[model samples]
Target chain A: MMQIVKPDFEFKKVYETLYPVIFRVAYRVTGDRALAEDLSHEAFIKYYERRNPLPDLKQTKYWLIRVVKNIALNYEKKKLREKKAYDKLQFKYPHFTQSGEAEFIKEETKSFVQKALNKLPYNLRIVLVLKEYAGLNYKEIGSILGIREGNVKIRVFRARERLGKIIDSDAI
Target chain B: MCPDNETLSAYFDNEIPSPWNKRIADHIAECASCQKRLRQFETIKNYLHEDREPSFESSLEQLEIRLAGLKPRTERVSLWKRRVAVPLPAAVIAAICIMILGISLIFSLTRSNLRTMSIRRGPSGTTEVQVAAPIEDLELLLKSLDTYYLKQEIIITLPEDSLFNITGEAMMFREAEFSRKRE
Candidate 1:
């Protein structure tokens, strides 16, 4: 018989508390508001589905946020998969100038640090987001990302340094 | 020497372990170059933290709708799937090892169907083990020792059907007897 483990905490309470934090993390990591919302919901749905293999409710907040990050990573892979299809679509529809001012304007409309953040590779950006937004220590970030604590520290610093450099260039 | 960028960054995060933390703190306090580096990091930290919050009320409403629709996905994991998930190579290797061990054990058992062991005295007056000999031969030797019992030499109290008496071990016991005779 397949056993299902149900935690003591109410699902609604967990949702209400964690939903916003996960959304923010997904947003910061993916740099797309819509994608962030979708990822957050998907993560919640997945965590809900895991009633058969329930995660510890005490660590649910962190688990939810990490799932958000992972969902963003999956989106990156999806983007890679669609790259060829996108190229073909671009070739077939030359009138579709996605490289035009509208896209650039949308980027410029984003916040300065967010624009700088969007420029960073997702791995570096997610580490920074988890540290700053989630208020996670290097060890916590490392545990979530399956990286060494020391590597987490280095990535966070390099991310900050790169972000600073980008902002400086944008200012110039 | 000034710590590398990574170490300084770790120091900035207070992620550096102590002794090093104390040392770096002292160094950053004293060193002009490190102070400038630290100030740059502080500026970046402030900029990252000082963000305007976007209105996520609409997103939250959409999330509520999604959450309302979401049902717990029933995952019926079968025992067959679990059994298959275990690596086949490891299982095959274990089976091979067990088979090899069984075969060797069978061969050793089949080899041990001998009657008795032929124990002969070496040139150094120690008994060496050889092939099987008759139990009657051992009984004859013991009976001779009974006839030649000058004092309490070789006090063997084995039963009539006790030729394979392993308690009277071959080499070490023979060496002890030889030493007693020399004394």
Candidate 2:
């Protein structure tokens, strides 16, 4: 008799296959390893928690992308709240010791590129990472981000343009 | 008119048709500003394309260990059921934690209401007095009294002849005073 496999085991296999990609995407989005792992795990848990199975791998990927995006957005909001609190405390007391070491790395062109990318709006970061690191085409990124393909293309192009200017300045 | 930004973008992407591509290329070549812009775009693209991957094999081992800590010991079974099982408890636990945290916060805010009551023997009757403090501190005080006296138990002999009204959050000791005699 053919043994019946459990849905949970099948779900684990699927998660294992996709976990690496999801981790990379989450890491790029959150810019923190621990946060990336947390977001990825949360995405997986949410994905599996649904009573109905996902329609297909394509849909699953889309769900993962959306979940991670929301998680990263919430994390950003929390960070902003914490920053505001810290600033308020510092302004009031002004006697606390600042944490961590300050180091100056070499002045490389890559630093300029990084600075330029950071200067872009968060929406632009989403588009660029989706296209650049995840290697999703314009239409796929659009579907993932719920924007029109033309919008995705336009944003990415603008991001690249801004980045190019910064890079060229550093190069010269 | 100068070529539109989309056309310029298309030219950067190498997506414009051949004749249009040549036209844009010639325009960019002649225009130092546009040439610089194009070169800048190329540089950004190069930086973006540069591989910045962490060593996944090493990361994967760490992930494996982290996952193992949370993995259930059950053999291969319905993943669908397993997936459903996982988040339900997480949500439930989160709700429970929120409830506990909220209660603690409320308690901390209103802790001044916590009270302690003492009964002392008097000539005509027992007099009951109250002071405010944490229940845990009250219990600790009682426990220490028992230990210091080295008695099998500390019996508060209430004379049942005086009327006393005490209002406090932790009035359970009054009930305990009544309960001990019955026992």
| lDDT scores in order | 0.74, 0.65
> For model 2, how does the per-residue alpha-carbon lDDT over A71-147 read when each residue is reduced to its tens digit?
88888779788879888988998985345222132213224444556556678777887776666777788888888
| DockQ of candidate 1 (2 decimals) | 0.26
Candidate 1 has what TM-score?
A: 0.62
* Each candidate's interface RMSD: 3.8, 6.7
TM, chain A, every candidate: 0.81, 0.75
Q: What is the Cα-based lDDT of residue B92 in candidate 1?
A: 93
Question: Judged by DockQ cut-offs, is candidate 1 incorrect, acceptable, medium or high?
Answer: acceptable
Best by DockQ: 1
TM-scores vs. true structure, each candidate: 0.62, 0.53
C-alpha positional error of residue A163 in candidate 1 after TM-score superposition, expressed in Å: 0.9
Instruction: List CA RMSD, all candidates.
Output: 15.2, 22.1
